[model samples]
Target: MGEMSDTGRLVLLGAPLGNSADASARFREVLATADVVAAEDTRRLTRLARDLDVTVPGRIISYFEGNEERRTPELVDVLAAGYLVALVTDGGMPSVSDPGYRLVRAALDAGVPVTAAPGPSAVTTALALSGLPSDRFCFEGFLPRTPAARRSRLRALAAEARTLVLFEAPHRIGAALADLAAAFGPDRPAALCRELTKTYEEVVRRPLGELARWAAEEEPRGEITLVVGGAPEVAAERPDDDTLRAAVAAREAAGLTRRDAITEVAAEFGLRRREVYTVVHA
Candidate 1:
């Protein structure tokens, strides 16, 4: 039996995405035993510690996106010094559309053993509560800010048949919903979840167009996740070239280049570029 090498040990501690009670046994054990805790937000970590009634023995350091570049060496140095290092994001799993990725890479590069403390996640939470298909789904983390860029992205994903999950900010919820309605069709079935496990948690299901309208008027609040139904099953008969051309034209109007538009249309029609190009140019 041998002690785990410090140089190769990295624990990815999952924090509660919401409701504090969701913290798991493994999470508490890791927090209690790890020699160093790299937190996205030290203050939040402190609060979570208070909620869990756990006192951490090691030093807690800030390691967020803004300071990730500068903090990597420091974290890596600590791990190299033979200390058990644990990485935690403000919520949910670290490095998942969060700030723990760089440190994870650094530790792995140094041959550090990495593991996780599974806990709550808004992505899965939304999907489970979405009232949509759970068998298959994809997570499309926060869409771009610019309307044009956002629409282009949605257009690209429009053909995705599996359920789709997305994160969005409160301020941009209305615009994002509007764009989804446009790209996926106003009638697409979807759910808008807000605040998750927090006190203000809310989940609303409706057509994308109506959700957009509600978001426009109601001013949504809290951490939002949107789960949308996949594209309707297309009939065996191929949609006419005219339909494909129209879709390409719609995405083009939303700012995607002709090249990108063609790709989007081809995906939607399950056609190859050469196939779509021939139809579009015909």
Candidate 2:
């Protein structure tokens, strides 16, 4: 709380997920200089400061999911008053699947400048170690806890062509993997990153079915991030109409109904089922 600057700004500081060494110099400087530090967990922030050997001289306030709605306005007022405010979470960046979204939106709406001291992120770390296609990917965060809802969500992403990144709890990892395998097909490749940046860090890469079976045997501990490969790319040269019709006929001869045969063939070649249906009927 030294001499306050004329203009205040909301600073989103990314805290390390596990390793203290991952904390950035900019993060330390901000912690020491900011007029106020709003943390998702005040206790965790205290420990992080101690580990980094940095002292936070300003007022430290708790800002987490439970109180984010009520606390956002208060922090926004600090920013409006020309006092620098830093927001940190228990681990990684704020608002990636955590608190800080409401506060950021409020700050932007209030016309207070918002910036970030970006540091280690579980999402990117997991993706980089995933060994899957990284050029294009999407972060799905956490899936629904309930089985039906979770399966429905996975089914919705069944046709997603970009690599998918998700966060899951250790307790639900097995069930989640099972749902993923069922929705995305058992052979889909995936990587499970556990305890990223920590001493006990581990990454398990395998087909979704295998991973599901492995998780059932033993539950993994620590923060978990999942990186799943996209649906297999469709061949650039689509099969001819005769080939499509023959494929559907093969399935139909194997005991599937004509409609089901078309659906299966369409999925196999990444074509629209309706298109396959038309070709088969023609």
Candidate 3:
């Protein structure tokens, strides 16, 4: 294990999403010698270290969602003192929709060197294995849990053109898929990747309706990542100039700022902002 680097550094280590073999060699070295190993769960980290047969020589601290705000400042102080700090979560990359963002931000403010030890990531893995469009996609993380909130959120994203990736729990999978089908159309192509890269892994690819039906029978174990096809592109509309202007006017009347109203109207009419603003304002 090497001593802390002269320069204060923040290393974001990507722990194995699953399977110890997926862990990068650099990850092992960093865990062995970093001045501080801040993990989401120290117990889990210890188990992982044992799994890889690597000893973590540094102080192991818990840095999870509940305590991230309180722990960040202290970790920043350590980093400022030229200590090497490694951030790891229970799985995959740190700070990618995880609890490492707070520490990363603190390190950035302290001018600590920030780097990543990339390894397995469920987001990209699910996308790649889903047979969906990978060239362009978006990560929406987890949707709202409440039915009303989730439905509204889904409706807002219903017209999204790029493929969407989401993380959801096993218990909520049924409702989530039902909401997706209702909002984005039952026929939308999608893949439900459960326990990716682990034993008992399953990928169900079909219409959202089919996935919902499958989930109704039995819930899969482990983490779940959903990849849904984007909304189909509709042809451009050629509404009359008066109708466009009226739409913007209506939005403004409904308490939207001029800029905000224009954005909403532009999407509705499938017109560019510049085009909508020019036509509406003119």
Candidate 4:
């Protein structure tokens, strides 16, 4: 579409999660111009190009979990040769619970310039639709496959205060939700988003216990993104006015600005800045 420079670059293309219309113009340009295309599923890439009415005439290489290790070096070599290399996964962006991490790292290590052809991602899509806490959240890709390991991982994450996002296969949906409820508590709020951006798209919002029961009975089908409410913070004992004043003073004496000291003290004790400000002034 534009003049091709001799400069080599690696572009990570974000594929539409499910709906083809989500393909952006920038993404199409990168796909068409890339000299070498490394795709998680070559067939799916071809189908996507067809859907978007964009022709990908570049050399297509299959790069998935099975051959990522073997194909990584080859991709790096091509990137080193001033080739415009583009990587695409079946759905969503590459490298997030998908192939392309090793290749990206390898390309960067080889001093090859790398960038992204941004598009919609299921993580944000589901999180937004779930109506869960969006400000502070962590995407935990997918839970461990094995039962024992998955349980252990959940145990470790039980006390995480940040909202949790994760992917789950249809078959394991029931088990995963049950384990989550056990680890995070039955009453913890959560939302299960499935078949996102598709005809049968559905978002089920409920507590962990209710979701677990629903999954067990209905057995959801399609790619699932789960958003779980963060663990409630433990209530902190409110320090007396003297203690708050002394704490703020100590922080200020340790080289913090008065306002910064007050902010830190308020956050530490879970008090509002205004509350601390009034207390200090009084």
- Winning model by TM-score: 3
Q: Write the per-residue lDDT of candidate 4 for residues 23-113, one digit (tens) a residue.
A: 9899999888888889988998999999899988788989999999999998888877778889999888889899988988998898999
| Per-residue lDDT over 1-282 for candidate 1, one digit per residue giving the tens place of the 0 to 100 score | 124353646799878987889999989988888888889999999999999999898778888989999999887877777778888997888887888888888888887677888888888999999999999999999899899899999999999999999989999999899889989999999999998889989999999999999999999988889999999887766888788889889999999998999998888767788888888788
TM-score of 4: 0.83
lDDT of 1 at 117: 82
Model 3 weakest 10-residue run by lDDT: 1-10
Give the per-residue Cα lDDT of candidate 2 at 81: 83
Q: List TM-score per model, in order.
A: 0.82, 0.84, 0.84, 0.83
Global lDDT of each model? 0.88, 0.93, 0.90, 0.91
RMSD, one per candidate, in order:
7.9, 7.4, 4.7, 4.8
Clashing pairs in 1: 8-112, 8-113, 9-113
Taking all chains together, the TM-score of candidate 3 against the true structure is: 0.84
Superposition error at 173 for model 2 (Å): 0.8
Model 4 Cα shift for residue 262 (angstroms): 18
Taking the tens digit of each residue's C-alpha lDDT, what string does model 2 give over 47-87?
Answer: 98999899999999999889999999998888888999999
> In model 3, which runs have C-alpha deviations exceeding 4 angstroms?
1-6, 237-282
Task: Quote the positional error of residue 22 for candidate 2 in Å.
Answer: 0.7
Q: What ranking of all candidate models by TM-score puts the best one first?
A: 3, 2, 4, 1
Candidate 1, position 199, lDDT: 91
